[model samples]
Target chain A: MAKKKSESSVSTVPSPASSRAAGVAPSHTDLLRQMLLIRRFEERCAEAYALGKIGGFCHLYIGQEAVGVGAISALRADDYVISSYRDHGQALARGIPPRTIMAELFGRVDGCSKGKGGSMHLFDRNINFLGGHGIVGGHIPLATGVGFAIKYRGGDQVCLCFFGEAAVNNGAFHEALNMAALWKLPVIYLIENNRYGMGTALERASAINDIAERACSYDMPNEVVDGQDVLAVRDAVLRATQRARGEHTPTLLEVRTYRFMGHSMSDAASGTYRTKEELEEYMKRDPIIVLRTTMEKNGEWSDTAMTALDEELKAVAQDAWDFADASAEPAVEALTEDVYVW
Target chain B: MPVVTYRDALNQALQEEMQRDDRVFLMGEEVGVYQGAYKVSKGLLQEFGEMRVVDTPITELGFAGVGVGAAMVGLRPIIEFMTWNFALLAMDQVVNSAAKMLYMSGGQFNIPIVFRGPNGAALQLSAQHSQAWESWLAHIPGLKVVAPGTPYDAKGLLKSAVRDDNPVIVLEGEMLYNTKGEVPAEEYLIPIGKAALKREGEHCSIITHGKMILVALQAADQLTKEGIRVDVLDLLSLRPMDVEAITASVRKTNRAVVLEEGWEIGGIGAQVVDYIQRECFDDLDAPIVRVHQVDVPMPYAKNLERAAKPDVPKTIAAVKKVMYLDQ
Candidate 1:
């Protein structure tokens, strides 16, 4: 596996000089492919919700595809990842089978969490995706502890804890970061600053706009990146992860991003805090569109190949939906199982 | 038989358990370097090294979650809080993850972790440092709550807790750690959800556990001198409590006195008495009596603290009242 190091190098596409330096790649085709998969999957979830198929609190990871794919693309398969309730895109980007994720959403026996955890508690142990914790910032400390375990067991695994900008105000967020920095744990605290935390915009809640600067309080290095640009997000994570693995130093990455969807499937897009015009402006910087334009210019992608991958993804997503829909609910006796180590 | 202090028995139980199972390990504040707050885990670090007998930083939540995660995998982790009072910092991990993980995951994950430490009023340790949290833990369905009174029960129960596949909270009384008793030098397993009969009688059943067990035993001896045969039963586990033993004793004795060191209103003793009344209401010769500390903070002075806690005199009076001896 070490001999395939060169083959594992991150892909590239051309972008603006400023963007390129920050790690924005020109590979619009690949970026668009990932963004489309997430968008279509979430759209299907929204449809499922309307049809009364998926129950429990379902937090869709729609316009936040770039933060997950761009950042996750920089990580190795062995590295661990944990995220908050808005976790579907991250799980997908980390290579979890869509069928398992859909099954979890559908509350089927075949789900990643075996139907025990619906939308809020998605857990895929195989992909090293710890969970989709329902608590606001409950899993932050958990990620830091896992990082400590990785270091303690003498492993090169880095833990990426993805939380929202709203979590910056949480006591756990501060407490976990301080402890992580103090212990010099191999972790990257990725705050996907998507402006809104649930219903409230972050500006209305957080006293500090730049969460990356908060890392300074713990004497850790911080970086601010364009979350919309997959390449840029990847670059920031690559450097931070390298430092975490090499020097055993923790890094904080504040990815400035926006979520095009409401907090949940039920929430309307219209709101007092965000204007339609502002939403449109951010949509112009849609990660998929930016990547696609770059790929077209770089000649790394063609319309035919893009079309083929799009069809392939749609078919795969449909298969996932069918598999989840056809799967049976767990047995009634299973309700009392796994409570104790009997 | 070996004369062992309650503290040494607990240390031996932990040491023996660690040696017996590779997955069994201890994690706490001073459990490794300083031995333990009460020296209950002394000298095990040298034998097991840092891996098994881990000395963690004072981040209760962090270590507690780690214990939960480790238990979720294959390891059986024994989490020692400096005192059960400090476990409040990790209550979410215990209550939410360790206790409810099985039910919430639809029975996919069973947490085989033990959260053990001294619990309840310990001298003048102050209000913040001393508490009886067994009732709070017992309220949860999945957690097994145990509080042992004697050296034998403590060693046997602690070993059982370590071996149990479910999360168990073993509440060791701080004052009872030094109390000495004869412990058998052989492997023994104490099944959870079982009660122990400390003394045999027929007049009135005295149901109690932990520190109050001593009080009940003393009260039985005193009552025997007065021609009152008081049956004493030590409740080892609070959850999945021995309802059968309690109800059967209450039926046989025809009267009862429930004793506990916690506040009188919502104590484990109250639960025992309630269960007896609910299960065997027709068998009562007299109304049930609850002997507990007055509803007040444990005082600092030794006399005041003793006055606030249930003692042999209080237990004797409660037994007499329940058996109609005064009548």
Candidate 2:
């Protein structure tokens, strides 16, 4: 097989001018703020989990904030979003209220899924956020179906399906991609290659480490982007979404990123499967700091302003925690509700 | 009214529903180009065109999930599995995604999709292909399991299943595809979760559904000649089981025998027995006897396969046992 050129390889550096030329992009400061909010929200979630406030398996999206924030920024309000279990960032990026997400984590009735979905199964139909499906690669087919519906209805809406690198190994991934490609459905299969699927390293799980290369079998257009850079992920995803909406074509995008925390709260962040050196190397390219430095270089933000912004985000996270704490548990009668529709 | 085969009845239901609703479409392996594996979806592709009657790759999980996704967003998808045995590959999507989406999303999504296919034993398909899944699927809370016996019920119930705003599993009998029955010339729909009394009798009630209904009828005819009138109750829908119809039949006859094409343990008969004993214990003249396929994987040998399945003799024996005439 010949080496396939990644569509995103040409644009490694972030250019605000290019982003502006792309038209109506989120300001650099706004993107930074959103990523910061997600970081703080995840940190608060870890603290709450330790305090026995948030039960069930809680997978934090600490390091891969840029991938979620950047990709979701490109999608239209009517478009659908579906992701794997590590979904706090995606939920926040899709504009689900932080309080509702926090309440869902707290298993409250005010939660998005009314305490039924808990952490891994957050859903908001109003914004078209399909779900935070717990099973790996299980939601891929759903995304395909969403695309099929759009085509069947003669709509230009696109579906964005996000999964980890480990999900590529699942049979569902291949099956969904094949169907989407064959049908010429409007969908974007975004792979957040965070280097580790739970404790299993990407090298240990997948035969071909370059996740985008696997898309060749489906004859779908594919790209690899620097997931640590918010602008790069945004550009690639925007292009993919446009292709999906305009041409009714699906794209397989592999965003190279990493997670700073363990797979979930259960796994110790100790360097057992991975080394401290590897973790430190990825941390040096931390997505938030990378974007913040770019803004600083452009003279768009100041040190004092950045500090104030961090404090504001912290306050936002604190308010969400407080709101979730005060929310009521779901009524026992609600246990049977929504199970069936007549 | 016209006489039609079970396969033609199902095809008519699909054609009618597709014509009635543009949102409803047929999708499965060989459904479009090959006219369905058993011709259940025959002439549909040519009628509805490729966009509606989609021919999918041999990927059950993928197509099943796609059907679910489409249903979530306001499309009524009719996903044919070719066979219920092959649906095992896509059970995850069926059970986890399609069935639970409405509840998990807190009533935001109602998957109005029908997963229909031929189920249970057919000739010598044997073991892997011959297993009946009505009991297993009925065990699920969010699903409606429909197994029709006659062509009339097949067409009417399927039309209703397509219209239902929930995940409905229509288990078509493979052996009954060629069987003929009279169907209404005009439009009609048989409501799900309702039973039909094929034959009313005074002595004993033989309750069954799907292909076993035929065996029950034959047995009823044999018992009638011996001066033992038997009530043949056909349970068209398994889930949301028609307990009222069952109790009424048992009450009328004061004796009952449950028959099934599936394994004896944890089968539909077992569930019917539980309902009868609990609700109609006073009306029963004797303990209800269950006739079901033997508790073993269906063997490929002709004689062994015949012995493993529930047949006319077995139904007669069960009815006799309930009537105290088998000793």
Candidate 3:
């Protein structure tokens, strides 16, 4: 695989400049803020995990913040979002508040799922954020069904489905995509190609290198975006959303990015399958750094202002931690609640 | 009252429910153009159009999960497995996705979906295609499992399941589809978690569900000829079982027998026995006995298949054993 040395790729799809011309002016400052919020929140999550405040397979979204922010930034408020277990980034990107998410990770009653669901299963009916399903490739078909319901009721809403590159080899993914394309369901099948399915690399698991190209088998239109470039990610999603709303079509999007941290808190970032040199190579093109540099070149931002915003986001994360610390654990009687509805 | 086949009664339920609610739709491999494998959905595609009466490709897990997802967002999807045997491929979606979605999502989402098809042995279907699924699905916490032996209960209970706010599994007897029974002309729904007395007596209580209810009734007839009058209780639903009705009948008769179409090892009968021992222990006159399928995969030969499954003679034998008449 030819890794891009530059921090950002020049997208062949509509660029950020082209989007501005097309009357879809994206708020770059807000995008950067959202990405930074996720980054800071996850940094705190890592700290809490290390302190044993949070337990059970906590995955940090340190490097892959741009994909969640940019893609989610393109959707309407009514549009739905569903993803795999590594989902705190997507939940934050979907505008679920930091405090409620933190409370959920702490297993408190104030969490989004009322603490019934933990970190991997955050859900909010009000915002249309379906959930972060635990099983790999499990929620893809659920997203397809959301699209099916939308079309059935004669609505224009689109659902964004997220999973890892490793899930492409799973049967559920193929089954969902085939049905979505065949029925022209309005869903965006987004694969965050962070290169590894847990400990194993994609090349060792999947039969082919071009993950998006496999969309050809289902006859679905496909796109590959520079995952670190938030603007590039937004443009690809905007085009796909347009197709979804207008033609009731589904798109397969491959966002190639790198996971700066380990698969989860249990593993080390440097040892085993990935080397320190590889991590260093990817760090130079860090999404946060890339976006800040672009804003600086455009005369829209400065290093001092960026530092202030970073501190503000960190404070917000710190406040969430405080809120989570004081929140009460769920009542024992809640065990039998919500299991059935008549 | 009007006479109807069990298949036609199920079809009437689907048609009536689809007419009542726009959220109700049917999806499976042959539910649309093929009009259902057993013709349970005949004339539905023409009434509701292809979009509602959908024909999915041969992906059980995928389509089953899609039904759960649709149900999450407030669409009532009726996913018909070609048969209960084929549904094995989609058990993960049924059990993991549909069954747990409401509980896992903290009540944020409820899957109002039904998975129905011909279940149990259908004449020499061999080992792979002739298994009963009541015990397997009833064990799940957030799901409702119903198996009706009569056409009236078939139509009524199906309508009830369609309107339910949770996932339900409707296990229709494959052999009972062609059987005819009286059904009401007006709309009615048989509530789940209730048992119906198919036959009344005083000597003993013969408990059963699904197709075994028919064999139990037949045994009751034979026992009556032998001067042993028994009560035949058809357990309509398996999960929220009618414990009150069960204990009431056992208290009156002081003897009981359970007949099921599934295997004996930890089957639905075991749960019934547990409830009996706990609730009606002092009222019993003799030990309870269960009549079930033989502990082996279904055989191919006609004679072997007949011997493997419980018949009227086996049900009678079980009733007699519970009556303290070993002969």
Candidate 4:
């Protein structure tokens, strides 16, 4: 089919006054750049996976970039961020260096986890990125505990926990939310409703399709936002974070998004479970394209600027791959190390 | 020195640790207003208030993960599982999350937490509630397992566990809770991975821990009356397995009899036998013997429960058999 006229008009140029009135200064451009960086980074990762440079389970964040980049933009440096296995974007959005994350995926000594945790487990304690836990909903409880620790220490800092939409069915999700609500812990449970958990669609897996409504049982404030829109997610998460920091209230946020690629590199991007039409439909609202169009239409950005930015980000992603390729494998003696502190 | 029951000793250790460190807090079912199911945390809620002394819901996996998360961020959380049997619900958190976080994070995180609760059978509590899990926990590499047999060891080990910068599992003996022993009022900490020799003898050694230590001692007493002097070695720590102490005692006695309240398969006794046979193989004058609970679920009937567990008679029989005595 054909592209709609309205979709083209949405990218029409805007006046300088309108851009200023929208307050699209540091954010709109920055969010676009970050989302582009993640897109390019994940594209290179898929190539690296095919080349056998990166091993283990590699879950890409191709389409859900806006959810991670947007929500993380609202967080402070001192606040904590935890997410599920598809965390390359979240880690990059949380400001973790691309080189370190790439090296981790390469299983090299310079990796953040020193080659111990492969792609599925990326961690940087310095930035308070707890980890990229592999288990479906295992980290929910841990995130609640992080909120508990912050509250116990009398800190206004909030923790943002990201998981797949399917995690709502996990007992840990319910138990952790109940505890967070009962204790009034400062935590925001962000669900990246990416339509499918691996191959199972959300509707087939969840009895209640509206995940945000499930939080009401625990008396938590919640919202469902357009995850493909970076600004929308950023605004919603900012409001929730403010409430968490101000009143020590926990919020459940369900970001309605879709993945462009299959679950992982192992999955064939075919129409076995999902229809080709569904992929094409969601591709129309690609987060990077949407954000770039919005910025370009507002006159805050240009085609030449984005083209130059894309080249720069491609170099950055390439530099990460080069650094990972040149890095040394962990020493044999290091195998037994880090098992225990003592 | 002050004479206190094992339960009071644990309570004192928690109170002292919480008083000493502001980051140390307690959370579990019935640990606050209910004062603990076994009253092990008696009077703590009144002193520390609800924040430090938390009363968690019956969601073991949730709170246990919370304790791990809290520990990750430098809060020393003492997560009490009502019993080791109930801890099965949270094994994912205990074994998978807490035990593997440090290694998985490449030494970035140190889980400075303690999972404490009464372990093993306690007077015919039936199958579900009556199970020992020391061996199961000790199998994990990143965890430190400590079982205190007496009031003095209980207080000392617990204090050390709280201060240790790693995940420690303190398995208290339910049957030994009311048993009293002399505990010093002065600040003391019994180093972990060290065993205490309760009674020294020349004929054979009775190596045990937890409630079985008392049974071993009683068996030693009975063996003394029958002219068989058996050494009683109490292995307070299971994971680190006080190999030096076990080897030294086995070398001296030239024979060993291991005792445990868990099943025969993969019990602490099995570990001891492996260690003794490997290290003290040539030093042994006779084959090492193991006395453990019968290989079956603990029955509710009083007589069957007594027959199912490792008692003084079983210990005495093992010691006598290792000494080459008939009957």
DockQ for the candidates, in order? 0.38, 0.77, 0.79, 0.74
**Error in Å for residue A76 of model 1:** 3.6
Clashing residue pairs in candidate 2, if any?
A: none
Candidate 4 local lDDT, residue A53: 94
Per-residue lDDT of candidate 4, residues A295-316 (tens digit): 7788888778878767767777
**TM-scores of the models, in the given order?**
0.88, 0.95, 0.95, 0.95
Q: How does model 1 score on DockQ? A: 0.38
Ranking by DockQ: 3, 2, 4, 1
> Interface RMSD (Å), each candidate?
2.9, 0.8, 0.8, 0.7
Q: On TM-score, who's better, 1 or 4?
A: 4
Local error of candidate 4 at residue A244 (angstroms): 0.3
Candidate 1 lDDT over residue span A272-315, tens digit each: 66888888899898877877777777877777887766666666
Fraction of the real A/B interface contacts present in each candidate? 0.30, 0.71, 0.75, 0.67
lDDT of 3 at B9: 96
Name model 2 segments beyond 4 Å from true.
Answer: A1-23
The 10-residue segment of model 3 chain A with minimum total lDDT is: A1-10
lDDT of 1 by residue, B149-206 (tens): 9999999999999999899999898889999999999888788889999999998999
lDDT of 1: 0.81
- Candidate 4 chain B: worst-modelled 10 consecutive residues by lDDT: B318-327
Please rank every candidate by lDDT, starting with the best. 2, 4, 3, 1
Quantify all predictions' global Cα lDDT against the true fold. 0.81, 0.90, 0.89, 0.89
